[model samples]
Target: MTFSPRRPLTAVLLAGALLAGTAGCSTFSDSGRSKYAQGEGKPAEDDDASASASSSAEAELPYDIRPLLHPDKKYYGLAAKGAPASMKSVKEFASSTGKKPNMIEFYSAWGDSYETTLAQNAWDYGALPFIAWEPFKRSLAGIAAGKDDAYIASYARSVKTLNQPVAISFAHEMNGFWYSWGTKKATPKEFVRAFRHVHDVFEKVGATQVIWVWSPNVINPMPKVRLEPYWPGDSYVDWVGVVGYYARTGPSTFPTLYGPTMDQIRAFTKKPFIVAETAAEAGDRKPADIKDLFQGVEKRDDVLGHVWFNFDKEADWRISSGPASARTYREQSRSSRYGFDVTKP
Candidate 1:
């Protein structure tokens, strides 16, 4: 999801200059290697843990598909029971459209208020579980900050109770200026420390029922120099997820938005990668744009899935829901961009 213009504007202006200097290499010595290691343990250990987790990592759906946030607007408390026709349609499409189960993102705050609604709906709908939980927002803000300790603990318990394999994404988008985690003047080391600290807490608490997801924005449009300080070591992250989107205000093509960051992070880590959140505006966003985004990176074996940012605010000026988006997506199936036919490729 794109951040409000108020904060990201400055980041955008600085991107070009930063890209030019990515050529000069920076050393990640003491800060990157020490301190945080004490609390989170050695990166080697985390790496081995992640590797073992991968060997037996629960098998993913045959074709990658995450429905993003709840389709039923009701979960947002914006619709009454059975009122979101669009969401309902998308749910049916995902379940019946293919043989495999489709995944969906479950935002953390929403969990407190809408878990029952989502759980009930998820059970009935046959939506594959790719649960994406964001607990870091409240925690880092000092709002939740481990106080209830029992709160996230309870949330983890609730998720585990669901008995579905899920991916818990805490404080994602760490590499971008939009989120609170990345907003401060944090060096990569500091970011790494903060990231590991949170994960360590989860591990200490015994929340292994879920997979750990470390997601960051594709290379910030800002230059490389400014971006280097954000690379927390590759060891701590289990699955590498990236948020990439196409909008009129930004780059014209999907690949332009996703390519560089996808390539860079892929080079840095061996973990499975996901286009965690992605979409193109409906009207202004040609079906071709969606195809292009996937087309560019479809070949990467490391690339595992694509979760559309089915939010309504960032529209293509035409469609307001997933049904319309899916139609446009299928209509353009003849193109190379439509490489996700579950039956074949």
Candidate 2:
């Protein structure tokens, strides 16, 4: 369903009266009822009315998702080394070109002894580091269970030491069929709870440097189901992210994925958005496709930036340089995509 804006309310107050002569401990108090009514409290309600009202409010104003920013007008980020061996080479390429790699989506799972090596490499290269935490893997199962607050707390503390902005995408592509976060086909409410719980730990530890990117795959046709249940409260997200990959498998194009999905995400909240991940496969990464994606973004002030997934992990990446990826990057990097004059700004 397309999202509609919610109504604004004012002057909330408690409705119930206190019992003066109660000798036993009463579960519901006048202040408690009022707190629940105002959404400042979570009380067990026997009647569905109160619960329903609170649930509806949650659906509208869910969690406190953050806003992602780019101080530079045209944000240039590179994906370096899904594995350790490639990091040095990728970093060398970006440094030669004078662009600090904005963020690296490290494919390291939790508790890898080699992570210290990878983290050190990122620190030396001056790269913003991020990793996909795969707790569902057997070795990390306990951490994924949501019962391990201590585990999350410890990880948050460790990441704080890195002193670089880290985006810990626990289970990315949650809206896609691939990940266990949405593996059971959780309901939207369930998804919201799980997603928020992870953030709750980070927030509690005051890890404000961490910019949460709720990344999902672009809406797809059947045989490839889209899992919307994994969408947490807008409050839980810092940036709305979609992974858009172009393929010759069918009628898919960059526009077919990026444009409409951006529209769908923008329909509900005004949070800044990003093309969390992407790769093109079409002939020369057609200018028309690049134009379509930018046209969809230009007018909207809410849309912040796009991160071109810069890797050749897949055989169909269609990657090229201005000379090498010339046909593709040249047309794709036109000024409109950045929405600001890099020269002037």
| Runs with alpha carbons beyond 4 Å of true place in candidate 2 | 1-72, 82-86, 92-100, 111-120, 123-126, 138-145, 183-187, 222-229, 250-254, 282-301, 321-324, 330-345
Instruction: Tell me the number of clashing residue pairs for each predicted model.
Output: 9, 6
Give me the candidate number with maximum TM-score. Answer: 2
**Model 1 clashing residue pairs (backbone):** 15-221, 15-222, 18-223, 18-224, 19-223, 188-229, 281-316, 282-316, 283-316
- Tell me the TM-score of model 2: 0.63
TM-score of every candidate relative to the true structure: 0.61, 0.63
Query: Candidates' lDDT values, in order?
Result: 0.45, 0.48
